[model samples]
Target: MTTGAPTPTYPARPRRSRLRTFLPLGVAAWLVLEIWLLTVVADATSGLVVFLLLLGGLVLGSVVVKRAGRRAFQALNEALQRGGTPESGGGNGLMMLGGLLIMLPGLVSDALGLILLIPPVQKTLSRYAERTVDRKLRAASAGSFGDAFQQARIHRPDGKIVPGEVVRDQPGDEPQGPVPPLTR
Candidate 1:
């Protein structure tokens, strides 16, 4: 049948991605693995062994927190004395996070928490967090930090101040007439 009107065609719906379908399966598999491993461990050693391990992990996590808390408080005090935020001193958050993870009733979290308690790993994580925060700020602020930082007198080296403004120049765009006069 021929008609002058065009045929009405509906847009195709998007298909569900493989990741969405497989993620739950992967999580289920991991949970099953953990259960099987725990069962084997329980059967091989007595339930007492599992209980001891959990108790030991809890004790260790508490010890780590007690030790780190002192250091964190010292750092926080020093930062306050120096007129800076407690967070600026670093390490406190990671240490606390590690302790929290260790406190969780899981071998995997305990292992990760132990790793995070390491000085080098804590420092690396702190730096990564700083970079991630900086990146988010930059992206959200639309390059304001970069532009302001560049022109900021406080950031100037050699103690010399220079005033400047950022001018955005886009390619393939003609200049819009002449620059307007500054108004008071």
Candidate 2:
């Protein structure tokens, strides 16, 4: 029968997964690798060469985006005007993504972007995107709405998926009584 304030309780914190614990380490590793690459490039070539290459990538990426983005926007507009699917009427999104990647300050990203900017590579990517979207649409149309919702996966660091289910509680599921007192 003490008059002191009742001890408060809270839900236990969720356990951090192994991946979450090591995510910072992964980022640090990537930073170290990038630094090493930059150092090697500077040593083999020259600091000035590295600077020039980075500058060239940035400028070229900007120019590519400017030209392609305008055409994409115009095509998209025209498609919309004609009441057609806007999917085919624009620049390859992957190419634009590559251009954006090139704009980032890394030689690896620049090289990847340059590869993406290639016509054959862009075409291949575009075809792959179309096939993927078509497959997704086909699946969505063939399955129940819940099937689409269940596509989300939670994977462990060991590459195993955590099993779970979607639970929908009824509207009238409020607890009938909550008069039990807390006890130590």
Candidate 3:
């Protein structure tokens, strides 16, 4: 019989996660809303007024984001200095994102961003972030597997019996050589 050709097997492609799809849609909606607001502002107010408002929003957002960023960095640094991993869940990136959202030409985004920039809210967010990180660390440490004997036996301060093998090697003895060695 003639040799048959091999069948081709294609590799499966990885699908994009829902978050990836939703984030772009959300950003696009925000942009469209901002454009609509800009048009409204242009129609209702003079160019000078729009410019002033934009400037004010930029300045306010910058100040808020900067202060939050500094606090977040300081907290992260302190944690790292104490031999712990820095908590970055609610870090400068989030604050910057909020500030940028505020800079969009819309009242709603600005208000939401302002709320996010508040110190009390940021502090609460940071505490929650820290706790989350702590929980993850604890879970990871707990989940890790070690040598069975490590857990099987633990020495007590008082001479008490624990259920496990204890092997002790003494330092003194030497065995005689060539003593009826091996039989096949």
Most accurate candidate by TM-score: 2
Candidate 3 residue-wise lDDT, 137-158, digit = tens: 8876774355444666755544
Q: Report the C-alpha lDDT of model 1 over 8-100, residue by residue, as the tens digit.
A: 575587998999989999977866765676677789998888788778888888887887789888988988999987767357778887988
The root-mean-square deviation over C-alpha atoms between each candidate and the true structure, in angstroms, is 13.9, 9.7, 13.1
Pitting candidate 2 against candidate 3, the one with the higher lDDT is: 2
lDDT for model 3 comes to 0.73
**171, model 2: CA deviation in Å?**
24
lDDT score, candidate 2: 0.79
Distance from true location, Cα of 134 in model 3, Å: 4.6
lDDT of 2 by residue, 1-184 (tens): 7699777665599999999999999978876876788889999999998898779889988887787788788888888999996767244577688888788777777888889888888888888888999999987699887765666666555445665676776998876687586232
Which candidate achieves the best lDDT against the true structure?
Answer: 2
Preferred candidate (TM-score higher): 2 or 3:
2
Tell me which of candidates 1 and 3 scores higher on lDDT: 1
Regions of candidate 1 where Cα sits further than 4 Å from its true position: 1-34, 87-89, 143-184
Clash count of each predicted structure: 0, 0, 0
Error of 1 at 41 (Å): 1.6
Predicted structure 1: lDDT: 0.78
**Runs in model 3 lying further than 4 Å from the true structure:** 1-5, 69-100, 104-106, 131-184
